[model samples]
Target chain A: MNLAAHLVMLPVLLPLVAAALMLPLGERRRPLKVMLNLASTLALVAVAVALAMRAGTGAVDVYRLGDWPAPFAIVLVADRLAALMLLATSVLAFCSLLFSLARWHRVGVHFHPLFQFLLMGLNGAFLTGDLFNLFVFFEVLLVASYGLALHGSGSRRVQAGMHYIAVNLAASLLFLLGVSLIYGVAGTLNMADLALRIPAIAPADRPLLEAGAALLGTAFLTKAAAWPLGFWLEDTYAAASAPVAALFAIMSKLGVYAIARVWLLLFGVAAGPSAGLGADWLLAAGIATLVFGMLGVLAAQEMARLAANSVLVSSGLLIAMIAVGNAEVIGAAFYYLVVSTFALGAFFLLVELADRGRSAAADILAVTREAFGEDEDEADDGEVGVAIPATMALLGLAFLACALLLAGLPPLAGFIGKFMLLDALFAALTPAAGLAPAVAWLLLALLLLSSFATLIAMSRAGLNRFWAPLEPRVPRVRIIEMVPVALLLAACAVLTVAAGPALDYAGAAARALIAPQDYVEGVLPPPATPEVAP
Target chain B: MELVLTIAIGVLTGSGIWLLLRPRTFQVIIGLSLLSYAVNLFIFAMGRLAVDVAPVLEDGTGNSDPLPQALVLTAIVIGFATTALFLVVLLANRGFSGTDHVDGREPPP
Candidate 1:
């Protein structure tokens, strides 16, 4: 009845309604659709901010659709982690919308509506408290993504989009299989109810439930782009139009978020026999993904492919730390998730602007020269003073910021995030734990090595694009395009400045996740009054 | 009856996965469709197979579980949409690349 009660559903409903409203308008009404889309996204941001503030106060707000009771009817829960994810998504969506307005919005039909639909799906995915509902939302977002990926259609985009679509379709089937198995065994799809039921499940049924969870996890990890399953990500993200790719930076994280939410809630210590289920597989998979991503980053020549590979590194790091199952480390992982997501989105946007100056053959030539060990024909003129245009300077600074953030270089939010994670990893070590300490050390080494690899790859890309050209031809970047990149980088700067509060929020969110009681109780409250059938 | 359904699912899934790995786009699409059919049946069985029973629990006489039916319906609709979308994308890929191979090019003979 009150505004607080309604706040939980607004994020999901706002975009759906906005998208529906935009669908009826004709192509001639592009400006109107854009205006509607922008206004809706801004309002979603406002709602997300309010939700986060409310959740920061440590109150779990649950909105039951049609006022149905929990465990039977659908409910949307807004706890700290959900609110944090919603806030991050809304801000990223707003920026991507702004970036697309410059030219991408006109490149194809129904771009604005599809964007809104994607937002709706993403918000719904984050907010839903039901597993089947989660599957529905995954389908929702994936369908919208399929459209967006193929937008501004080109030969390469179509080729990549086909693989992306086929792979995801298979993943979706796996998702359905997993959900049905869990439902068949647990007899419930509501996450809170499953937490209550899993501990009491028969020992014979336990394996089925775990199998279901593994299948579900596989579906999510495929989206997260882990190791062998992640091969599609590089080509797909590389070939996608810039703004769509930027928006997709969060989509990969969506998989990690789902795992964190569902895995922790259902299989936490509260589940007795089922406690710590699948943690080992997660760790092994995460390590493999990190190593593979490191190799991918080192091998990449194109800026977009490089950024996509770096996304794999971030995802692998998060998934591995999450498997470590320490609240402190999980908290640090959340911090890293936020920072890396923002950095990756900015880098994807910047790739378009920074890449426009050079001919398409530049990157390939650089690679070939490296392979052949060719010396530069031009003599090095140290300290050649060339007047740089203001636009080029701004673009270069943003690119530098992205590079620093992705590579975890010092004096930026990325460095702070890695430091916090490493610190938490060290703090979590114990004598009685046999293999954890070894895993901690391995992860520590991988983190630093991946950062170094990203630095090398990014520097090679930066030199080729910005520094390699003797007479730098500045790309014609519009104000609309530049502002979004600046806004994202500025967010990273702000994150760096306010590290204490950000880390504190992440800690609280992680603690809530590690202890599922709060979420379970929040979703399934004691019956206030017995329902009277009319 | 359960064994028959299980075997059917297993066979469908096996064939689907095989076709999914093939080089041709059309075969891949058929593979996906077969896979979805298998999944739809699998989900349906998750509700526990019942014959000639009302899905709704009116008088509670041999009522089948209704939830998986609903879930399967949603999955079916989504599977249909994605198949159509994949078809369109495959056609577009063919239009651009001038090949039916999933990789967008033919292998040398």
Candidate 2:
């Protein structure tokens, strides 16, 4: 009934409506396409701001569709964590949209429409209250991504896109299988209903539930680019356009978010042996992913490929933190998600700036000159252009933020997040817990090492481009591209400046996730009978 | 009986993985499809292999687990769509790259 409640639905609906409207607008009408894209993204930002403001008041806003009671009907719920993620996503979406504006004409048919649809799916995924609906939203997003990933029809993009699509589709099937198993055991589709129903199920049925949970987790983990299942991410991210690549970076995190949400809600309270096994399994998998991803990032050569690999490492660390299930780690994970999203988003934009021209000779010369300052004659004769000085300045700042953030350096959001997660991991360590301590220590070491590796790789790439010599002439920095990079850089600055409130909010969000009885009660009324017929 | 079926599905999954690792795009597709069939059956079996009982509430007696059934239905539809999408991508890849290799590239000189 309140304005905040009304704002909850707009993030998803605005994009859905925009996508529909853009379908009728011919692709050749470039101005109209740009207008629609900007308008919709701006509207999402407004809605995200409102949601954040409302969340600050200390209560989640739940909207049930068709005004039906929670268990029987669909619901859209927004807690502080959901609100914060939506805000981060909107920031990335806005920047990517601005970056794509100038190139809209060149991107060919349905680019704008697919973009809008992708946002619709993202917003829906963040907002949906039912497990089944999450799958639908994921499908919606992936279908759109398939188009965006292969937009240019180049062999590399097409090949990478096929692998991406294949792996994702398999994961989706696994996800559905998991859901069916859960439904069979719990008899409810609504998350709120399932939360209450799940804990009450018999012990004999618990293994099925655990298996279902693991299957579901596997599906999401694959999407999150967790190790062993994430072979497709590096190639896919490397091949896509910068704007699309930036969007893809945020999209992959959706899976991590889902896993965190589901685990805390369902298994966080499961008693006895089940809890021990569930927690241990998650911790093991999370640590393995962290180590594998970090090794990959350290070994990567291509700039785009390195950034892509870094995403896996960061997500893996977050998952490991989530496995600890301490409130502090949850808070840290939330903050880390925001910082990583912005940093990676900016990195993709920077990669676009460097690779704008198609000539290999120009690229090599530009890199050479940028790495070492030289007079025009001394610069590579093949060098055709250079990055604008102002753009280079922004790129420099972007790289610095990325290094500090991803490396978990002091005074940045990433540092604070990592510190909190490590503190939680330390507290969780015990002699009785046996392997957990070893795992925790390994995770901590791998996280630190990975962050350092990301720092070095990015610095090398950044140094080669921004700090090196002047080519005879530099490629002009396009205004459209600069807008996204500037906005993301601004976001990182805000994160650094407002670390206290952000961490506090994240901590509160984490607590809310750990004990979601309120969410359950808010969505579903107390059962009519203490026990329902099985 | 159910255990045997589960083992059979596991074998199917194993074979699918082997094929998926092969270099050809067509083999990869076939591998994925095989894996999907195995996975779907495995998922359905997790509901504990109910027979002669529908999940729908009936005659005030017993109903099989409704949740897994609902989940499997959606999974089936989504799986079908994904398979179709993969097939289309395969066709497009062959057309664009003039090869059906999974990597769509010639081995290095």
Candidate 3:
């Protein structure tokens, strides 16, 4: 097999194998564990790069499990969108791993294994071509995430973890229900097959199909933290460790990705005018989530909570953009997802630095009290926390990147994405399509208001933390902590510079996704009569 | 029979949601469990009601859909894992905070 074929599977298999390998290694061998993680991520990056190259050349790489034809057996597919997401996934995973190197000792046993398994699950979900496979991968990732979320075993972590697990498990049940109905009616688990078959089902059965679709959408929307279903996110993200929190950011987006894929493929034709809550419902929910998230951000007291709320706002924007359904808007959604993930990942890393800084300062204060025996006043006098000026500056830079990304400031990738989406919405507003015009205007207004709210919230955080003077002394920032934050921030800078190519590629990917007949044909040869579920 | 069962599931869901809104952690867990049961049954119903038919395919005979059965198996396992994880987390929170409240911190003075 060519390298592209290997690329399709390596992202998932490498991590699965690495996780198994790590399990046998002694817990004391931290260096070996780190090496395995780094190696696996590097391998994934290489595969992602190779896949991107192939996709750029306009080739869709499909891997048939057990060498069986489509609709008969499982398949893994890597298209332009999958490759782009794979690249983003690997980039975030690499940066998070780098951040965890120093913090792993704090996290203790099985962190390496669990992290690798989580990556395995994430990659599997992205690559799988079958709906059932997607469910399996989701479960795999959720299991690992449960352990990682509760890693520290603290009271707050536990409380948040319970909510997280409860919500996700409920979503999983809905997912199973939806898939079962889809399969019973459509008689296929293969996504490509379903796409081809679902449209041909009898009009009378369409309502039943819509119910299944709605159930699936509900589950995915809950996972994506959409309005009215996202109550668990703020507290859960706030309580998670910084590195683990960064991983969770991407996890939420996976649901959005799944929703986009299923809607554009299986339901787009069947969804027509008769389907009650198609893209419009998503757009409405997205706007509501955006407004709610911004409010949460403004209400937040802590830096971590603020960042968490910002994630919801960005996710809402992405979902709304996707709902527009125009090729250009979908392209913009892809670009926005990439930018948001990068910015949020960097923000989480900065949170870790700030946390360590506070912890170290506390330790220093304890030592000072011990040294000045019986003189509590002396120990407290003029001795403030140690603040590392350089670390603060780096964190400030990261904050700037995050602010620009979230607020849609110019010269950043977020600005370009939002501009493209708004342009598409404006173009869609034609007098002939009266409803479209009103919806387009509403979406644009919502986007603008959300951006303004984010700007205010972020500025408040920046002013309170960076502009204000710290206590007399603050702990020095460690190099180990600074490296990952700097690397992720640099990635954001590079993404900003490469916005043109990124948007262009996203446009092509979106076009391909929206019109998936090519993908369906590529997966399965046309049948004499396309099977339609009754 | 199916209508009655569906209504029962709906009642369970309503009760679960009510309990979920409570402030206590243990109550929330119980609520989640009740909700899960309701959800599982609801999912099973989506396959369409079958009294005597097995999900397995037989020669030239109608059988209930097997796909939902496979999905339910996966859901059951995942649900169990999540429930176990939740219980562990609840115990850990009780150990640390000396209270079984969902919000660990005391309200601002």
Candidate 4:
């Protein structure tokens, strides 16, 4: 009845209602659609901020839909970590939506409604206290994403959309099977109830439950773009339109977030044999993903693919740290998740605009045309600039900021994040742990080497685009496009300046997540937890 | 009855995975639909099969576990929407590239 009680559902409901309101409206009413989207996203941001502040106070806000009791009816929870994820999503969604207003909103039908629905789905996933709804929300977001990915009518976009759809459809199947397996075994889908039930599960059922969990992890890893299952990532992200690509950056982290929640809550120390069952797999997969991502980054011919590959590296680092199941490491990974997603999203938007003025055969076309005494190149509306244009200058600065953030350079949030993570892991790594020390060193080396590789790839890209423009032409960028990129980069700057509070928030959120009792108790009312034995 | 359902699911999944590895777009779509069927049935059976029983819960009367059924219904609708979208994308790509291959090339066929 109170505002805080209602606040738990506002984030999910706001977007759903707005999207529904926009659905019947014709695309010809573009201005109205844009206004509705911007207003809703801004409102969502405000609501998320309030929820996040409330969460920071260490109180878990749970709202049962229809006021039904937990473990039976659906509940939406806003714990510290969930609120943080919601806040990050709304922030990125706001910026990306603003950037799309430059022109992409009109490129396809139902863009506004789909965007809203995507937001609704994302918010619901983060807030839901049950696994069934998580699957439901994953489908919702993926369907919207499929629409967004193929928004512009291009053969390339459609090609990539097919692969994206196929892979996700398969992943969704896996998700369903996993959820069903868990439900069949545990007879419940509510996460808190599962936590209560897991400890008493029969030893005969343990392997089945673990199998279900592994299948679920596979689904998340596919979405997260882990090592072997991440083959579709670079091409799909590269093929997506700019703003859509930017928003898709957070899509990978959704996987990691789900893993963070489930691993800590349902399978933490309370789950007996299931405690930390798949932690080793997460570590191995994480390192392999990082290594493969490093190769992808270096081998990328286009800057767009490089941006995509770097996303894999970010996921790899987060997944590896998250696997260690340390409070401090999870906290550092949380901070790194926010920073790297921001940087990658900004870089995707920039690459789209910056790539406009260049032709496919840039160097060959320039030299051959000049040798043939043909000025056909200059006729393409781009003028060689004597002085750098403001657009290029702004783009260069944003790219530099993105590069620094991506490479974990100092005086930025990325550096601070990597430093925090290493500091935490260094304390855990020892020769006595046998395989862990080698993994620790490998992780540390990969972190630094990936950063170095990013520097090289990004500088090569930077030089190609800005520094030594082979054909220096001012890229036609509007104010709307530039504002979002600058705003996102400014956020990275603010994160750097506000690292103390940010780190404290992340630390508290991670502590809450690592200590599962707080979350389990928060969602469920005080009652007898029935113990079952086979 | 459980044995029959389990074998059916296994056969569907094995064949579905086999077809998923093919490079043709239509074949891949078929594989996906097949997999979706398997998963939907799997979700349905999560409720523990109740033949000739009312699905709705009534006072003291036996009913099937309806949650998995609800989830499967949602998955079915979503699966339909995606199948249509994939078909559209595939057609558009075929028109543009003059190929049915998933990668948009005929591969020397």
Residue-wise C-alpha lDDT for candidate 1, range B1-109, written one tens digit per residue: 9999999999999999999999999999999999999999999999999999999877757799999999999999999999999999999889888999999999999
Error of 4 at A524 (Å): 0.9
Candidate 4 on A126-195: residue-level lDDT in tens?
Answer: 9999998998899889989988887765667778888888898899889989999999899899998888
Give the C-alpha lDDT of model 4: 0.85
Higher-ranked by lDDT: 1 or 4: 1
Candidate 4, residue A404: the lDDT equals 92
Better of 3 and 4 by DockQ: 4
Clash totals in order: 0, 16, 6, 0
Give Cα-based local distance difference scores for all models.
Answer: 0.88, 0.77, 0.78, 0.85
Best by DockQ: 1
In model 1, which residue pairs have backbone atoms overlapping below 3 Å? none
Per residue, candidate 3 scores C-alpha lDDT tens digits across B48-94 of: 77888889988877899766677677677767777777788778777
Candidate 3's TM-score reads: 0.88
Give residue A260's lDDT in candidate 3 (0 to 100).
Answer: 81
lDDT value, residue B101 of candidate 2 = 78
Sort by TM-score, best first: 1, 4, 3, 2
DockQ versus reference, model 3 = 0.54
Q: Please give the fraction of native interface contacts (Cα pairs under 8 Å between A and B) kept by each candidate.
A: 0.98, 0.70, 0.70, 0.91
Q: Write the per-residue lDDT of candidate 3 for residues A483-515, one digit (tens) a residue.
A: 677777677778788888888898998988878
lDDT of 2 by residue, A1-534 (tens): 576557778988888888898898775575787788889988888888889878867767888778786777788888888888889988999898877664422444578888988988898898889998998999989999998987655567788999898789778877876886787677676887777777678889888878888889899888888777888999998878778899888887898899888878777754334553467666767777778777777777667787788788877887777887777767878888888888888878777666544254245334434433435334423232333566556656766777777778887767877777777667667664343567778877877778787778777766766677334234456666676787887787788788889889988889888888767666765663254335
The TM-score values for the models, in the order shown, are 0.94, 0.87, 0.88, 0.93
Candidate 3, A204: how far from true, in Å?
3.0
